[model samples]
Target: MTASQDTIGQICKLLEPFNSTGKVLTPDTEISTDLNIDSVAVMDFVMEVEDHFDIEIPLNVVSETHSINDLAMVVDARTKKA
Candidate 1:
């Protein structure tokens, strides 16, 4: 699969359990408030994302991620660098 498709799949997998009630997330979607995800859940989500992408997400970057789009952009940028 291509990088963007792979990224979207990984995001869907990480977010499926939380947004199981048919919540659709666009590229500009907010994660915390929109998805009702707490800080701890975000941490876990970040770890899952890292594992899924086989890349280490920096703590600083994690701190800056306020939404699914933010996180996906970070991952996408990292993947591109790789």
Candidate 2:
């Protein structure tokens, strides 16, 4: 599915525990500071995103992502790669 059709808002909602507010977050949003999401929470977030997208997000890519937008871009790119 396309990124626009993928419902980032829903993903962000699942990430609410991470302090996301359903915003179009930027790459520099600071996943920890802006979202208050910890390392474990980030893992959970990655799992949720993977399930939602029906894809496997690489650990390295997940580690590289620092924001919602960054994650989205990674997902998009990975989806394309797949």
Candidate 3:
């Protein structure tokens, strides 16, 4: 798999703990609705993702992200720039 694909996989794994329903997550899964993540949880999740990817995500961009694919895209872009 490509680097982005690998990163996406890692991201999905990271989200597993937050998925209370134990449902399978996909890239298209909505972060808020599908994952049942609240605003508070979103902040914590973002922090963990930043730490995992070794990159800082801008707050504005974080707010705009809506799905797993959106986050993976942001993470991929940030990591590539680094």
Listed per candidate, the RMSD to the true structure in angstroms reads 3.3, 4.0, 2.4
Scored by TM-score, the top model is 3
> Per TM-score, what order, best first?
3, 1, 2
- Per-residue alpha-carbon lDDT of candidate 1 for residues 1-82, written as tens digits (9 for 90 to 100): 1237567667977887766447787665677777778878777878888888788897788888776667877889888888
Q: How accurate is candidate 2 locally (lDDT)?
A: 0.69
Candidate 1 lDDT at 68 equals 67
> Model 2: what TM-score?
0.69
In terms of lDDT, the best-performing candidate is 3
- Locate the minimum summed-lDDT window of 10 residues in model 2: 1-10
- The total of clashing pairs for model 1 equals 0
lDDT winner between candidates 2 and 3: 3
Model 3 TM-score, all chains together: 0.91
> Comparing 1 and 3 by TM-score, which wins?
3
lDDT of 3 at 43: 80
Off by over 4 Å in 3: 1-3
lDDT tens string, model 2, 1-82?
Answer: 2354264555566676666555445444656557667788788878988987788987787888776667767777767877
Off by over 4 Å in 2: 1-7, 20-28
Task: Give all TM-scores, in the order shown.
Answer: 0.78, 0.69, 0.91
* Per-residue lDDT of candidate 3, residues 1-82 (tens digit): 1237787798898888788877788888888888778988888888899999899997899899988888999998899999
